[model samples]
Target: MRDTGYSLRNAGCSLLPVRWGLFAVAILILAAPVAASGPTNPPNPTTVILVVGAPGQDEFGRVFAESARLWLQACEKGHAQSIAIG
Candidate 1:
């Protein structure tokens, strides 16, 4: 009598499910190439320059206000000088 135990049942291997999982992962992995091909260069970026005065509590406001007043006085005088020069 032959004892065809459970060893015979496990001898043959099926690659269908493994192949499907690999195919799904392969499809997911291949999208990176398409993404890489699209955008070779990016658009130009915008820039802005801001002059923000300090808040009152930090003593920045007082110094800034004094500097601004001096600048205004100089500008006013500069305008008069320009007119005289012309």
Candidate 2:
């Protein structure tokens, strides 16, 4: 009968779990700073640009109009200090 129990190959595989645990800990430590900080709001005095295609042209004009309307709402909500509509 051969001594097949606790071979060197099996010993090497046993270290896999420890290596993965250490890797997980390192990742959490590196991500601590980003996780601690909450979401950040955009800077004040933001300039909002609304570019629109020429009206009364085609279906694209309708899309541009809708986009412009949404941007106007954002601007009114204090999301931007000024808007340049073109």
Candidate 3:
């Protein structure tokens, strides 16, 4: 029961657990607005277009077809949504 001035049990302690608890509560209250302040508008979905044309010097159209297939795969994944071809 010695007065070390830092114990929560000491009524005269300047740094009590209650004081620390209040400090933490005050910090959380002040930070609540910041934590809740995200983008008011959510992200808009994206659109992508894949245009496949004649590969001038290619013996076959494999390159163009492969590129288009990759684009389709991207759309299938969550990375892309609406897609069109021209």
Candidate 4:
């Protein structure tokens, strides 16, 4: 039975498989879903309307900004969903 300083140092370090180490932790984190644990806030209901005449441009803008702002108060609103005139 030999008790050596090398054995003591080796005991302090990791001898188990590398996969069972920090790599496994990272794999678990990446594999986990990003969504929250509880029920989600629900996606905002966005509306898109195609415009033709010039008069409706103003109206479309108003409706898009208003409804989108109203329904999805805390959510991120996209300009593309709001208004587009052609």
**Residue 7 miss distance in model 1 (angstroms):** 99
At residue 46, give the lDDT of candidate 4.
Answer: 61
In terms of TM-score, which candidate is strongest? 3
Candidate 4 regions with alpha-carbon error over 4 angstroms: 1-3, 8-20, 29-41, 54-86
Error of 1 at 42 (Å): 46
lDDT of each prediction vs. the true structure? 0.59, 0.79, 0.74, 0.57
lDDT of 2: 0.79
Candidate 4 lDDT over 28-56, as tens digits, reads: 78767653365676655666554434335
Clash pairs for candidate 4:
none
> Clashing pairs in model 1?
none
Q: How accurate is candidate 1 locally (lDDT)?
A: 0.59
The candidate that wins on lDDT is: 2
Could you give candidate 2's per-residue lDDT for residues 1-86 as a string of tens digits?
A: 88869775677657678889999999999999998997888578677777675777778788887878877888879767656557
Winner of 1 and 3 under TM-score: 3
Ranking by lDDT: 2, 3, 1, 4
What tens digits encode model 3's per-residue C-alpha lDDT throughout 1-86?
68666654455655567789999999999999988997586665777777777777675478787878888887778566655554
Model 4 — TM-score against the truth?
A: 0.25
TM-score of every prediction relative to native: 0.29, 0.47, 0.49, 0.25
Model 3 has a clash total of 0
